[model samples]
Target: MHTLDQLKQYEKEFIEKGYFVLDLNNMEYVKEASDLLQKHLQKITNNSEITLYNYHAFFEDNDKHYEMQFQMLQFFREQQFAQNIIQSNIDVYQFLLGPDLEIQTEPYLRITRPHKPKDNIGYHRDTFYGTGPGEISSVIPFINLSEKSTLSVVPKSHIIPDRFFKLNQVVNTEVPKDSKRHKMGFLYAPKVMDPEIRNDVIPIPLKRGQALVFMLSIIHGSEENNTDYPRWSTDIRVRNSLTSLNEAMKAGYYKPLKDSATTQTFERLSQ
Candidate 1:
């Protein structure tokens, strides 16, 4: 049971910092999500004890990477997986957006192979990818991470003007492009922000069962994963439940996350 005052404290921090990190150690879904991951990896690698930290040891094959990743992402479409994706961070969502929310159906799971420079994405905003101002982003690393092993984001960058977003759109395309080219916000930091912007950027070192919550419009990116193992993480975006049901957020694209009593009553009456 969280309180309205505590929620405002989070909002104040978020509005001033563009993002915040929280420990999800007690979150029920963190263990569930990890177990689910191990379950799938066991089938793929025939290793019953596979963990996210050892992700590289199992399925980083050049040949099978696509197939393996395809199947793993498809698993995200499962109700259990999607539920964990959103419900695990429900409190964070209520703080960032509102009590009622709708989360991305096509939530993503990313495995960054070690020594891959290209894996370091660019600094950009989610609005370039069809997210709205009402949206917020979520990140959970299944393994421990630090600088060059996890995400980096420019703090308070959401308060910047929309010109950078427009420029990113010209380079990244509002319409979906190859996912590889997408993290341009992290890629072209100079084009998006001033030379001093680097001062604002900070690498978030995250442990397993920790989550980073930020505004959808925040300037964020990642660095090379030089660690011995792959960095396994998941990313999902959510919006106010009352946001317009655009194609990107409609029935097939998003799932109902939480509904306020007022919303539930209204829906019941409308039905």
Candidate 2:
């Protein structure tokens, strides 16, 4: 847990830079989660040698690879992996957000294989996906991330006016036909179409034990992985429970992760 002074400094830095890298206080839970993923991958691939970085080598078919990824996402959510990490790092979250906090129920798993442009996300802000400024996003890498495979963000871009960039809504129509898509509606996210804006985006490298926490409005995305090893990471969104939430998010997309004493009291009294 960080001291009050330290947390205040962190908040100031976050406000100024729009993001910060944090070293997780408890790596035990992180390692446990990583181990669980590795075991599941080995079981599904039937190859003991398969690792997060080299799992792409086992699948030649794009559909099969995506199917594997979808299955892993299901497994990850079913196991409540994000909840464990949040619990372990509750202090930091509370300091960043508030004591009353809600977390996105379905955390996103990003698996970018080397030289796979299709797997990379385009530069965009979460606000384009209906998220509000109250929400913050955290990215946790399962493996060490190099500059070539890390997330890129335009610093201080969160405060930029929306009109400054030409944006386009991009729907992902590449899901494997055989696999059951998790969300029914068109899965889409807005992408920044301006060529000049791309120049400001810079890669943010992170180690296995570090997490990148940033404002949702920041213009950010990953580049095509050019390294030999694949990049694997999971990102979850969190917000103060009292803050405004989009209709979809309020309708059960987000769940309570922590509650203040006042909130708990109100819940009990209402019940």
Best by TM-score: 2
Report the number of the highest-lDDT candidate: 2
Write down the lDDT of every candidate, Cα atoms only: 0.68, 0.80
Across residues 104-201, which tens digit of lDDT does each residue of candidate 2 receive?
A: 88887778888887777667887776887578998998888999999999999989878888876554556333234433111443354676767899
Q: For model 2, what is the alpha-carbon lDDT of residue 197?
A: 67
lDDT of 1 at 258: 90
**For model 1, what is the C-alpha lDDT against the true structure?**
0.68
Write down the lDDT that model 2 would get.
0.80
Q: Give TM-scores for every candidate, taking all chains together and pairing residue i with residue i.
A: 0.79, 0.92
